[model samples]
Target: MKFTVSAAYYLLALLVCGVQADKEPLKDQSRLINLQSSRHHDVRLHCAHYPDWRIADEGDVLHFHSPHYPRLYPHSSRCGWQFKGKNEGIYFTINCQVFEMEAASGGKCKDYLSIKDESQQSQMFCGSQSPSLTVGNKVTMKFQSSYRKQAIGFTCTATAYLS
Candidate 1:
Protein backbone atom coordinates (compact mmCIF):
# COMPACT_ATOMS: atom_id res chain seq x y z
CA MET A 1 0.00 0.00 0.00
CA LYS A 2 1.23 3.46 -0.91
CA PHE A 3 1.36 5.78 2.14
CA THR A 4 1.50 9.55 2.15
CA VAL A 5 4.13 11.30 4.20
CA SER A 6 1.62 12.56 6.77
CA ALA A 7 -0.01 9.15 7.01
CA ALA A 8 3.35 7.53 7.59
CA TYR A 9 4.20 10.12 10.18
CA TYR A 10 0.93 9.59 11.99
CA LEU A 11 1.40 5.84 12.06
CA LEU A 12 4.98 6.17 13.17
CA ALA A 13 3.97 8.51 15.95
CA LEU A 14 1.35 6.05 17.12
CA LEU A 15 3.90 3.25 17.15
CA VAL A 16 6.42 5.33 19.05
CA CYS A 17 3.76 6.24 21.58
CA GLY A 18 2.71 2.57 21.96
CA VAL A 19 -0.90 3.13 20.89
CA GLN A 20 -2.72 0.67 18.66
CA ALA A 21 -5.99 -0.02 16.92
CA ASP A 22 -7.77 -3.32 16.41
CA LYS A 23 -10.80 -4.62 14.56
CA GLU A 24 -12.58 -5.73 17.71
CA PRO A 25 -14.35 -3.25 19.94
CA LEU A 26 -13.55 -3.20 23.62
CA LYS A 27 -15.92 -5.58 25.38
CA ASP A 28 -15.43 -4.24 28.87
CA GLN A 29 -14.18 -0.69 28.89
CA SER A 30 -13.33 -0.92 32.58
CA ARG A 31 -10.99 -3.91 32.30
CA LEU A 32 -9.77 -4.12 28.69
CA ILE A 33 -8.12 -0.71 28.47
CA ASN A 34 -4.64 0.38 29.54
CA LEU A 35 -3.24 3.87 30.11
CA GLN A 36 -0.13 5.70 28.96
CA SER A 37 0.91 9.35 29.04
CA SER A 38 0.95 11.78 26.12
CA ARG A 39 0.32 15.51 25.75
CA HIS A 40 -1.35 17.06 22.70
CA HIS A 41 -3.51 19.94 23.86
CA ASP A 42 -5.29 21.26 26.90
CA VAL A 43 -9.08 21.11 27.48
CA ARG A 44 -10.29 22.87 30.58
CA LEU A 45 -13.28 21.39 32.34
CA HIS A 46 -16.24 23.24 33.89
CA CYS A 47 -17.89 21.36 36.69
CA ALA A 48 -21.26 23.05 36.29
CA HIS A 49 -23.39 20.01 36.85
CA TYR A 50 -23.51 17.45 39.58
CA PRO A 51 -22.05 14.73 37.40
CA ASP A 52 -20.79 14.79 33.86
CA TRP A 53 -19.17 12.35 31.45
CA ARG A 54 -16.75 13.16 28.69
CA ILE A 55 -15.37 11.12 25.79
CA ALA A 56 -11.62 10.97 25.33
CA ASP A 57 -9.89 10.30 22.05
CA GLU A 58 -6.36 9.27 21.33
CA GLY A 59 -3.84 12.01 22.19
CA ASP A 60 -6.47 14.08 23.96
CA VAL A 61 -5.30 15.91 27.08
CA LEU A 62 -8.27 17.02 29.19
CA HIS A 63 -7.93 19.30 32.18
CA PHE A 64 -10.23 19.35 35.20
CA HIS A 65 -10.02 21.69 38.16
CA SER A 66 -12.07 23.13 40.94
CA PRO A 67 -14.23 26.19 40.45
CA HIS A 68 -12.19 29.38 40.40
CA TYR A 69 -8.95 27.51 40.56
CA PRO A 70 -5.97 29.27 42.20
CA ARG A 71 -8.47 30.51 44.77
CA LEU A 72 -10.20 28.95 47.69
CA TYR A 73 -12.94 26.54 46.71
CA PRO A 74 -16.41 27.10 48.05
CA HIS A 75 -17.57 25.29 51.11
CA SER A 76 -20.18 22.54 50.81
CA SER A 77 -19.54 22.21 47.10
CA ARG A 78 -19.54 18.99 45.08
CA CYS A 79 -18.55 18.04 41.55
CA GLY A 80 -17.84 14.93 39.55
CA TRP A 81 -16.60 13.76 36.16
CA GLN A 82 -16.49 10.50 34.26
CA PHE A 83 -14.17 9.92 31.33
CA LYS A 84 -14.43 7.20 28.70
CA GLY A 85 -12.59 6.48 25.50
CA LYS A 86 -14.23 8.11 22.49
CA ASN A 87 -13.37 5.20 20.24
CA GLU A 88 -13.39 1.54 21.01
CA GLY A 89 -10.43 0.00 22.83
CA ILE A 90 -8.91 3.31 23.82
CA TYR A 91 -7.45 3.95 27.29
CA PHE A 92 -6.39 6.91 29.40
CA THR A 93 -4.59 8.04 32.58
CA ILE A 94 -4.78 11.02 34.92
CA ASN A 95 -1.99 13.16 36.35
CA CYS A 96 -2.72 15.66 39.07
CA GLN A 97 -0.93 18.94 38.56
CA VAL A 98 -2.26 20.77 41.58
CA PHE A 99 -3.95 19.40 44.68
CA GLU A 100 -4.68 21.51 47.74
CA MET A 101 -7.61 20.91 50.01
CA GLU A 102 -8.50 20.79 53.66
CA ALA A 103 -6.04 18.35 55.13
CA ALA A 104 -7.16 15.22 56.84
CA SER A 105 -7.85 15.37 60.53
CA GLY A 106 -8.15 12.29 62.67
CA GLY A 107 -7.63 10.22 59.53
CA LYS A 108 -10.59 11.91 57.89
CA CYS A 109 -10.65 14.58 55.27
CA LYS A 110 -13.33 17.27 55.39
CA ASP A 111 -12.70 18.18 51.78
CA TYR A 112 -11.38 15.61 49.32
CA LEU A 113 -11.41 14.08 45.92
CA SER A 114 -12.37 10.48 45.31
CA ILE A 115 -11.29 8.30 42.40
CA LYS A 116 -13.04 5.09 41.58
CA ASP A 117 -13.22 2.48 38.86
CA GLU A 118 -15.42 -0.46 38.00
CA SER A 119 -12.83 -2.74 39.57
CA GLN A 120 -14.04 -1.46 42.95
CA GLN A 121 -10.87 0.47 43.67
CA SER A 122 -11.62 3.75 45.43
CA GLN A 123 -9.15 6.31 46.73
CA MET A 124 -9.62 9.60 48.51
CA PHE A 125 -7.17 12.45 48.24
CA CYS A 126 -6.73 15.67 50.17
CA GLY A 127 -4.07 18.22 51.21
CA SER A 128 -1.37 19.57 48.95
CA GLN A 129 -0.13 16.23 47.71
CA SER A 130 -0.88 15.39 44.12
CA PRO A 131 -1.32 11.81 42.95
CA SER A 132 -0.83 10.18 39.60
CA LEU A 133 -2.92 7.05 39.23
CA THR A 134 -3.92 4.56 36.54
CA VAL A 135 -7.51 3.65 35.95
CA GLY A 136 -9.66 1.75 33.50
CA ASN A 137 -11.09 3.27 30.34
CA LYS A 138 -14.10 4.23 32.41
CA VAL A 139 -13.42 6.11 35.63
CA THR A 140 -15.06 8.64 37.92
CA MET A 141 -13.73 11.53 40.01
CA LYS A 142 -15.74 13.33 42.62
CA PHE A 143 -14.67 16.34 44.68
CA GLN A 144 -16.46 17.32 47.81
CA SER A 145 -16.02 20.06 50.33
CA SER A 146 -17.45 20.55 53.78
CA TYR A 147 -18.35 23.66 55.72
CA ARG A 148 -15.21 23.70 57.77
CA LYS A 149 -12.36 25.10 55.67
CA GLN A 150 -11.46 25.46 52.00
CA ALA A 151 -8.30 25.66 49.97
CA ILE A 152 -7.18 25.83 46.41
CA GLY A 153 -8.68 22.79 44.69
CA PHE A 154 -7.00 20.48 42.22
CA THR A 155 -5.93 20.62 38.60
CA CYS A 156 -5.57 17.35 36.74
CA THR A 157 -5.15 16.18 33.19
CA ALA A 158 -6.41 13.04 31.54
CA THR A 159 -4.41 11.74 28.61
CA ALA A 160 -5.96 9.13 26.32
CA TYR A 161 -4.22 6.28 24.52
CA LEU A 162 -4.74 2.91 22.91
CA SER A 163 -3.00 -0.49 23.20
Candidate 2:
Protein backbone atom coordinates (compact mmCIF):
# COMPACT_ATOMS: atom_id res chain seq x y z
CA MET A 1 0.00 0.00 0.00
CA LYS A 2 2.82 2.44 0.76
CA PHE A 3 4.54 1.66 -2.59
CA THR A 4 1.32 2.31 -4.45
CA VAL A 5 0.90 5.79 -2.91
CA SER A 6 4.54 6.72 -3.67
CA ALA A 7 4.14 5.65 -7.30
CA ALA A 8 0.98 7.77 -7.70
CA TYR A 9 2.73 10.87 -6.30
CA TYR A 10 5.73 10.45 -8.65
CA LEU A 11 3.47 10.10 -11.72
CA LEU A 12 1.51 13.25 -10.81
CA ALA A 13 4.71 15.29 -10.47
CA LEU A 14 6.03 14.10 -13.84
CA LEU A 15 2.76 15.07 -15.58
CA VAL A 16 2.86 18.62 -14.19
CA CYS A 17 6.50 19.18 -15.20
CA GLY A 18 5.84 17.88 -18.74
CA VAL A 19 2.96 20.34 -19.22
CA GLN A 20 5.12 23.25 -18.11
CA ALA A 21 7.93 22.25 -20.44
CA ASP A 22 5.52 22.26 -23.42
CA LYS A 23 4.13 25.73 -22.56
CA GLU A 24 7.49 27.50 -22.49
CA PRO A 25 8.24 27.04 -26.22
CA LEU A 26 4.72 28.11 -27.12
CA LYS A 27 5.10 31.31 -25.14
CA ASP A 28 8.38 32.13 -26.93
CA GLN A 29 6.79 31.56 -30.35
CA SER A 30 3.85 33.85 -29.51
CA ARG A 31 6.19 36.65 -28.49
CA LEU A 32 8.21 36.28 -31.71
CA ILE A 33 5.10 36.55 -33.90
CA ASN A 34 3.98 39.70 -32.10
CA LEU A 35 7.37 41.32 -32.61
CA GLN A 36 7.35 40.55 -36.37
CA SER A 37 3.84 41.96 -36.76
CA SER A 38 4.83 45.23 -35.12
CA ARG A 39 7.84 45.61 -37.41
CA HIS A 40 5.64 45.20 -40.51
CA HIS A 41 3.29 47.87 -39.19
CA ASP A 42 6.16 50.29 -38.77
CA VAL A 43 7.26 49.80 -42.39
CA ARG A 44 3.77 50.56 -43.69
CA LEU A 45 3.61 53.72 -41.63
CA HIS A 46 6.91 54.90 -43.07
CA CYS A 47 5.59 54.51 -46.64
CA ALA A 48 2.46 56.47 -45.77
CA HIS A 49 4.36 59.76 -45.80
CA TYR A 50 4.23 59.81 -49.62
CA PRO A 51 0.46 60.01 -49.92
CA ASP A 52 0.43 60.50 -53.70
CA TRP A 53 3.40 58.40 -54.61
CA ARG A 54 2.94 55.20 -56.63
CA ILE A 55 5.04 52.30 -57.85
CA ALA A 56 4.78 50.79 -61.33
CA ASP A 57 6.22 47.48 -62.45
CA GLU A 58 6.99 46.24 -65.94
CA GLY A 59 4.01 45.94 -68.31
CA ASP A 60 2.01 48.06 -65.88
CA VAL A 61 0.40 51.42 -66.45
CA LEU A 62 0.21 53.88 -63.58
CA HIS A 63 -1.18 57.38 -63.30
CA PHE A 64 0.10 59.87 -60.78
CA HIS A 65 -0.37 63.55 -59.97
CA SER A 66 0.09 66.16 -57.32
CA PRO A 67 -2.23 66.08 -54.33
CA HIS A 68 -5.64 67.54 -55.30
CA TYR A 69 -4.62 67.71 -58.94
CA PRO A 70 -6.88 69.44 -61.51
CA ARG A 71 -7.66 71.71 -58.60
CA LEU A 72 -4.86 73.90 -57.26
CA TYR A 73 -2.27 71.88 -55.36
CA PRO A 74 -1.37 72.96 -51.87
CA HIS A 75 1.40 75.45 -51.36
CA SER A 76 4.92 74.47 -50.29
CA SER A 77 4.33 70.81 -51.01
CA ARG A 78 6.37 68.04 -52.65
CA CYS A 79 5.18 64.76 -54.10
CA GLY A 80 6.52 62.11 -56.48
CA TRP A 81 6.23 58.64 -58.01
CA GLN A 82 8.76 55.98 -58.91
CA PHE A 83 8.65 53.53 -61.81
CA LYS A 84 10.68 50.32 -61.98
CA GLY A 85 10.94 47.71 -64.66
CA LYS A 86 10.56 44.02 -64.01
CA ASN A 87 13.58 43.10 -66.10
CA GLU A 88 16.98 44.65 -66.49
CA GLY A 89 16.46 45.80 -70.08
CA ILE A 90 12.92 47.11 -69.59
CA TYR A 91 12.20 50.81 -69.86
CA PHE A 92 9.47 53.32 -69.12
CA THR A 93 7.63 55.89 -71.21
CA ILE A 94 5.64 58.74 -69.69
CA ASN A 95 3.07 61.13 -71.08
CA CYS A 96 1.62 64.21 -69.49
CA GLN A 97 -2.14 64.56 -69.81
CA VAL A 98 -2.54 67.93 -68.16
CA PHE A 99 0.42 70.02 -67.10
CA GLU A 100 0.15 73.45 -65.55
CA MET A 101 2.21 75.26 -62.95
CA GLU A 102 3.44 78.69 -61.97
CA ALA A 103 5.57 80.05 -64.79
CA ALA A 104 9.33 80.18 -64.69
CA SER A 105 11.11 83.21 -63.26
CA GLY A 106 13.96 83.18 -65.77
CA GLY A 107 14.53 79.98 -67.72
CA LYS A 108 13.91 77.75 -64.74
CA CYS A 109 10.46 76.77 -63.61
CA LYS A 110 9.21 77.94 -60.24
CA ASP A 111 6.59 75.31 -59.70
CA TYR A 112 7.76 72.36 -61.76
CA LEU A 113 7.45 68.69 -62.61
CA SER A 114 10.87 67.13 -62.61
CA ILE A 115 11.60 63.83 -64.38
CA LYS A 116 14.76 62.03 -63.42
CA ASP A 117 16.16 59.06 -65.26
CA GLU A 118 18.66 56.39 -64.26
CA SER A 119 21.41 58.64 -65.62
CA GLN A 120 20.57 61.18 -62.87
CA GLN A 121 19.71 63.90 -65.43
CA SER A 122 16.54 65.83 -64.69
CA GLN A 123 14.13 67.57 -67.04
CA MET A 124 11.89 70.23 -65.58
CA PHE A 125 8.63 71.43 -67.04
CA CYS A 126 6.03 74.06 -66.13
CA GLY A 127 3.11 75.96 -67.62
CA SER A 128 0.30 74.44 -69.74
CA GLN A 129 2.26 72.03 -71.89
CA SER A 130 2.24 68.34 -72.57
CA PRO A 131 5.54 66.49 -72.79
CA SER A 132 6.59 62.90 -73.41
CA LEU A 133 9.77 61.23 -72.21
CA THR A 134 11.33 57.75 -72.27
CA VAL A 135 13.72 56.52 -69.64
CA GLY A 136 15.69 53.37 -69.06
CA ASN A 137 14.61 50.82 -66.45
CA LYS A 138 13.89 53.36 -63.72
CA VAL A 139 12.44 56.85 -63.51
CA THR A 140 11.27 59.19 -60.81
CA MET A 141 8.86 62.11 -61.13
CA LYS A 142 8.85 64.89 -58.59
CA PHE A 143 6.61 67.93 -58.26
CA GLN A 144 7.44 70.93 -56.09
CA SER A 145 5.52 74.07 -55.21
CA SER A 146 6.48 77.33 -53.56
CA TYR A 147 4.69 79.06 -50.68
CA ARG A 148 3.11 81.67 -52.97
CA LYS A 149 0.50 81.21 -55.67
CA GLN A 150 -0.47 77.69 -56.68
CA ALA A 151 -1.87 76.23 -59.89
CA ILE A 152 -3.63 73.15 -61.12
CA GLY A 153 -1.01 70.42 -60.95
CA PHE A 154 -0.03 67.84 -63.55
CA THR A 155 -1.63 64.53 -64.48
CA CYS A 156 0.67 61.98 -66.06
CA THR A 157 0.77 58.30 -66.98
CA ALA A 158 3.71 55.97 -67.26
CA THR A 159 3.99 52.66 -69.12
CA ALA A 160 6.77 50.12 -68.77
CA TYR A 161 8.01 47.67 -71.43
CA LEU A 162 10.99 45.60 -72.44
CA SER A 163 13.63 47.43 -74.49
Candidate 3:
Protein backbone atom coordinates (compact mmCIF):
# COMPACT_ATOMS: atom_id res chain seq x y z
CA MET A 1 0.00 0.00 0.00
CA LYS A 2 2.90 2.38 0.67
CA PHE A 3 4.48 1.55 -2.70
CA THR A 4 1.14 2.19 -4.40
CA VAL A 5 0.81 5.63 -2.79
CA SER A 6 4.41 6.59 -3.68
CA ALA A 7 3.91 5.50 -7.29
CA ALA A 8 0.71 7.54 -7.52
CA TYR A 9 2.43 10.61 -6.12
CA TYR A 10 5.31 10.30 -8.59
CA LEU A 11 2.89 10.04 -11.51
CA LEU A 12 1.07 13.16 -10.34
CA ALA A 13 4.31 15.08 -10.19
CA LEU A 14 5.24 13.98 -13.71
CA LEU A 15 1.83 15.06 -15.02
CA VAL A 16 2.23 18.51 -13.50
CA CYS A 17 5.71 18.91 -14.97
CA GLY A 18 4.47 17.84 -18.41
CA VAL A 19 1.68 20.42 -18.28
CA GLN A 20 4.13 23.16 -17.36
CA ALA A 21 6.52 22.19 -20.15
CA ASP A 22 3.71 22.26 -22.66
CA LYS A 23 2.53 25.70 -21.48
CA GLU A 24 5.96 27.33 -21.82
CA PRO A 25 6.29 26.43 -25.51
CA LEU A 26 2.72 27.54 -26.16
CA LYS A 27 3.38 30.89 -24.54
CA ASP A 28 6.52 31.38 -26.58
CA GLN A 29 4.72 30.42 -29.75
CA SER A 30 1.94 32.89 -29.00
CA ARG A 31 4.44 35.72 -28.50
CA LEU A 32 6.28 34.90 -31.73
CA ILE A 33 3.07 34.86 -33.71
CA ASN A 34 2.04 38.22 -32.31
CA LEU A 35 5.38 39.77 -33.29
CA GLN A 36 5.16 38.41 -36.82
CA SER A 37 1.59 39.65 -37.18
CA SER A 38 2.61 43.14 -36.13
CA ARG A 39 5.42 43.31 -38.69
CA HIS A 40 3.19 42.01 -41.49
CA HIS A 41 0.57 44.61 -40.65
CA ASP A 42 3.11 47.42 -40.86
CA VAL A 43 4.35 46.33 -44.28
CA ARG A 44 0.82 46.00 -45.61
CA LEU A 45 -0.06 49.48 -44.43
CA HIS A 46 3.03 51.01 -46.01
CA CYS A 47 2.42 49.29 -49.33
CA ALA A 48 -1.22 50.25 -49.45
CA HIS A 49 -0.59 53.98 -49.58
CA TYR A 50 2.02 55.94 -51.51
CA PRO A 51 3.97 52.99 -52.83
CA ASP A 52 6.22 55.42 -54.66
CA TRP A 53 6.54 58.31 -52.27
CA ARG A 54 7.83 57.93 -48.72
CA ILE A 55 7.02 60.38 -45.96
CA ALA A 56 9.64 61.35 -43.37
CA ASP A 57 9.28 63.00 -39.99
CA GLU A 58 11.82 64.84 -37.91
CA GLY A 59 14.96 62.93 -36.92
CA ASP A 60 14.02 60.12 -39.29
CA VAL A 61 16.53 59.11 -41.95
CA LEU A 62 14.71 58.32 -45.16
CA HIS A 63 16.42 56.18 -47.79
CA PHE A 64 14.55 55.70 -51.02
CA HIS A 65 15.06 55.54 -54.77
CA SER A 66 13.03 56.32 -57.82
CA PRO A 67 10.59 53.47 -58.36
CA HIS A 68 12.68 50.56 -59.62
CA TYR A 69 15.65 52.86 -59.33
CA PRO A 70 19.08 51.71 -60.55
CA ARG A 71 16.98 49.91 -63.12
CA LEU A 72 14.89 52.22 -65.26
CA TYR A 73 12.08 54.12 -63.61
CA PRO A 74 8.84 53.29 -65.36
CA HIS A 75 8.13 55.24 -68.53
CA SER A 76 5.91 58.24 -68.02
CA SER A 77 5.85 58.02 -64.24
CA ARG A 78 5.72 60.53 -61.43
CA CYS A 79 6.93 60.01 -57.87
CA GLY A 80 7.37 62.39 -54.97
CA TRP A 81 7.96 62.68 -51.23
CA GLN A 82 7.53 65.15 -48.40
CA PHE A 83 9.81 65.93 -45.48
CA LYS A 84 8.57 67.74 -42.40
CA GLY A 85 10.85 69.06 -39.70
CA LYS A 86 10.25 68.58 -35.99
CA ASN A 87 10.02 72.28 -35.14
CA GLU A 88 10.20 75.78 -36.59
CA GLY A 89 13.94 75.85 -36.08
CA ILE A 90 14.45 72.58 -37.91
CA TYR A 91 15.02 72.19 -41.64
CA PHE A 92 14.96 69.33 -44.12
CA THR A 93 18.02 68.26 -46.10
CA ILE A 94 18.63 65.66 -48.79
CA ASN A 95 21.89 63.96 -49.72
CA CYS A 96 21.82 62.03 -52.92
CA GLN A 97 23.72 58.81 -53.28
CA VAL A 98 22.78 58.16 -56.87
CA PHE A 99 21.19 60.67 -59.18
CA GLU A 100 20.63 59.68 -62.78
CA MET A 101 17.88 60.86 -65.06
CA GLU A 102 17.26 61.60 -68.69
CA ALA A 103 19.50 64.42 -69.82
CA ALA A 104 18.31 67.91 -70.61
CA SER A 105 16.74 68.65 -73.95
CA GLY A 106 16.79 72.17 -75.37
CA GLY A 107 18.35 73.46 -72.13
CA LYS A 108 15.61 71.93 -69.96
CA CYS A 109 15.53 68.56 -68.25
CA LYS A 110 12.80 66.62 -69.96
CA ASP A 111 12.76 64.17 -67.09
CA TYR A 112 13.96 65.43 -63.75
CA LEU A 113 13.63 65.72 -60.00
CA SER A 114 12.16 68.94 -58.66
CA ILE A 115 12.50 70.32 -55.15
CA LYS A 116 10.06 72.98 -54.00
CA ASP A 117 9.97 74.99 -50.85
CA GLU A 118 7.85 77.82 -49.44
CA SER A 119 9.49 80.31 -51.74
CA GLN A 120 7.01 79.60 -54.59
CA GLN A 121 9.86 78.44 -56.83
CA SER A 122 10.94 74.95 -57.91
CA GLN A 123 14.51 73.75 -58.37
CA MET A 124 14.95 71.01 -60.99
CA PHE A 125 17.85 68.61 -61.26
CA CYS A 126 18.83 65.99 -63.85
CA GLY A 127 22.20 64.29 -63.80
CA SER A 128 24.23 61.43 -62.43
CA GLN A 129 25.22 63.47 -59.40
CA SER A 130 23.41 65.92 -57.13
CA PRO A 131 24.43 68.58 -54.67
CA SER A 132 22.98 68.41 -51.19
CA LEU A 133 19.98 70.63 -50.64
CA THR A 134 18.47 72.11 -47.48
CA VAL A 135 15.10 73.72 -47.23
CA GLY A 136 12.71 75.14 -44.69
CA ASN A 137 10.78 73.08 -42.18
CA LYS A 138 8.76 71.48 -44.95
CA VAL A 139 9.66 70.61 -48.50
CA THR A 140 8.20 68.64 -51.39
CA MET A 141 10.25 66.72 -53.95
CA LYS A 142 8.91 65.40 -57.20
CA PHE A 143 10.36 63.14 -59.89
CA GLN A 144 8.86 63.15 -63.34
CA SER A 145 9.81 60.75 -66.10
CA SER A 146 9.09 61.09 -69.76
CA TYR A 147 7.54 58.36 -71.88
CA ARG A 148 10.41 58.07 -74.37
CA LYS A 149 13.46 57.56 -72.21
CA GLN A 150 14.40 56.44 -68.73
CA ALA A 151 17.47 56.41 -66.52
CA ILE A 152 18.76 54.36 -63.64
CA GLY A 153 16.90 56.70 -61.22
CA PHE A 154 18.18 58.24 -58.03
CA THR A 155 18.92 57.08 -54.50
CA CYS A 156 18.93 59.63 -51.69
CA THR A 157 18.64 60.10 -47.97
CA ALA A 158 16.73 62.86 -46.24
CA THR A 159 17.18 64.13 -42.71
CA ALA A 160 15.81 66.85 -40.47
CA TYR A 161 17.91 69.13 -38.26
CA LEU A 162 17.74 72.35 -36.35
CA SER A 163 19.26 75.47 -37.94
Can you give the TM-score per candidate against the true fold?
A: 0.71, 0.64, 0.64
Ranked by lDDT, the better of candidates 1 and 3 is 1
- Superposing every Cα of model 1 onto the true structure, what RMSD results? 10.6
lDDT of 3 by residue, 1-163 (tens): 4545546556664564432222222335445432111111111111112434334444666665787866888888876776566466767677888888888888888788888876757889986548488877767777788889988988887676667
What lDDT would each prediction earn against the true structure? 0.79, 0.67, 0.65
Model 3: CA > 4 A from native: 1-58
In candidate 1, how many clashes are counted? Answer: 0
Best by TM-score: 1
Give the lDDT of residue 55 in candidate 2: 45
How should the candidates be ordered by TM-score, best one leading? Answer: 1, 2, 3
Question: Model 2, residue 90: displacement in angstroms?
Answer: 1.3
In angstroms, the error of model 2 at 106 is: 1.7
If the candidates were sorted by their lDDT against the true structure, best first, what order would they fall in? Answer: 1, 2, 3
User: Candidate 1: which stretches are off by over 4 Å?
Assistant: 1-41
Better of 1 and 2 by lDDT: 1
Kindly give the stretch of ten consecutive residues in candidate 1 with the minimal lDDT sum.
17-26
